[model samples]
Target: MLILGIETSCDETAAAVVADGRTILSEVTLSQDLHNLYGGVVPELASREHTRTLVPVVREAISEAEISYDDLEGIAVTNGPGLVGALLVGLSFAKALSYSLNKPLVGINHLEAHIFSVLLERPELVPPFLCLIISGGHSNLYLVESLGRYRSIGSTRDDAAGEAFDKVAKLLGLGYPGGPAIDEVAKSGNRDFIKFPKARMKSGGYDFSFSGLKTAVAIYVSKLNEKELQKRRADIAASFQEAVVGALLDNTIAAAEEHRMARIAVCGGVASNSRLRERLKASSETQGLLVFYPSLELCTDNAAMVAAAGNFRLENFPPDDLELDAFPYLELGD
Candidate 1:
């Protein structure tokens, strides 16, 4: 089945054509540089950028795939759990295309697409596994039993991991998309320079809380002299990154053990961190759990994952009518 996926949930305006979920015929992503200048994403700017770039980007994807609109069996778009204005651009375009082409339209949850990203790489991968989804806007663990099925095992009580990273990086004068910036500097630094507190919930559940850790970094950096701060940038980066990675890995492994699940997967933008990947792999091995992740490029927002998810939903669920609209806060299990 040929599916065209549109994603504009955040700062990226992306479109892709996926065949049978595994094969990505074409993918085009238009990133918003304006957000970087502002130190974070501005919703109004994101929506305007999406409106301007969505059509051309989608056209490029279709052309690159060497396919026409007539060849598509369905259209899939991220419907919610993101900026409502940003999401509307893709949703509106997708609905119009689906209605005009008389193809099935599936509303995909952004978080679900991240989980399905694993299936793109491992076609034989099944559910009943523990999943760690850490992104800019969210950090949650789930027991996934099948497509569109999820049980929330735990989630962040405060700041999401990615949000914490960005905030820490900003405080340190690092650039936007803090994950990469921190990861880059952390390569030469020591992970033990500044001891940051890891928040272990008192409830003894798998839930996470990075807000305290972020605050610790902020406080530590504030006390540093200009000379001391500049001299130990790498060490500070490494230490902060270690804390973030440790928190995620610890909770994820705990979830796997609690659920008695042998398969483990990490998804979303933070999943692209090399440190996180290495720790997850090592921890998974020690725990005797199989670990899965999307290729680095697919780790962030992309259309291929969206289309892959759409294909799964289209194959399993009945078609929806033109009344389907963008859902700003659709839950995963809903």
Candidate 2:
């Protein structure tokens, strides 16, 4: 089936055309740069950008796919678990398009789409695996049973790993979107230069917590003189990155062991981090487990993932009606 996917879950306004879930024919994404100035996403600005570019992006995807609108078998749209206004812009547009095209409409869960992002590249991936999804606003471990079937095993208790990175970067004056900033700076520094605390739950919960780690970095920075902090910034970045990724890898590996799952995948924005990727692959290698992930381009929010997920839903699930609305906080399969 040829599926048209629309995604405006956050700052990115994206659209894509995919064939039978595995083949991505064309994808277009326009990221809103307004958030860069604010050091975080501004929902209102994101929604405006979506409204401005939605049509052109979808049209471009279709054009690039070398297919007319009538060729599309169905339309998939991210319906929830994102900023409401931004989501509405895409959801509303998708609804209109679906109605006009007379194609099946599938409302996708933004988070669920992230999982399919990896599967889009690895269509034969076996299920009953563990997935660690780390991004700007989310960090969770899910046991994926099959397409559209997920059970949350663990999740963040406070700030997500990427959120911590952004906060720490702002503290260090590194810049917005802290993951890349810290990754670049940490390259020349020593990962062991300054050890940060890694929070392990006292109650033995499978959930992750980065709030304490962020606070530890904040307190450490408070004690440093401006000159010393500046001179050791690289070391700080390396050390902090090590602590965060280390804790994440350790818990994830432990989860795989506990669950006896051989395949582990990482998704979402932070999946693009070189350190996390390296560490995760290295760790999985030692345990004789398989690790899967999307390419760098697929790590962040994109319509290709949305399209892949939509294809799955459109095939197995009944089509949704035009009354389908944007769900800002919709939990998957709830």
- Tens digit of lDDT per residue, candidate 2, span 1-334? 9999999988999999999999999999988888889998988998998999999999899999999999999999999889999999999999988888888999999889999999999966879888889999789898898767898888889998899999999989999899999999999899999889889888774788998888888999999999989998999999999998998898889889999999988998889889998888788778899999999889989999999999999888899998998888787642
Stretches of model 1 off by over 4 angstroms after superposition: none
Q: 139-249 in candidate 1: lDDT tens per residue? A: 989899876789888888998899998998898888898989999999999998888899989999888999999888889989999898888888998999999999888
> lDDT score, residue 141, model 1?
93
Q: Which pairs clash in the backbone of model 2?
A: none
Tell me the alpha-carbon RMSD of every candidate: 1.2, 1.2
Per-candidate count of clashing residue pairs (backbone under 3 Å)? 0, 0
State every prediction's TM-score relative to the real structure. Answer: 0.97, 0.97
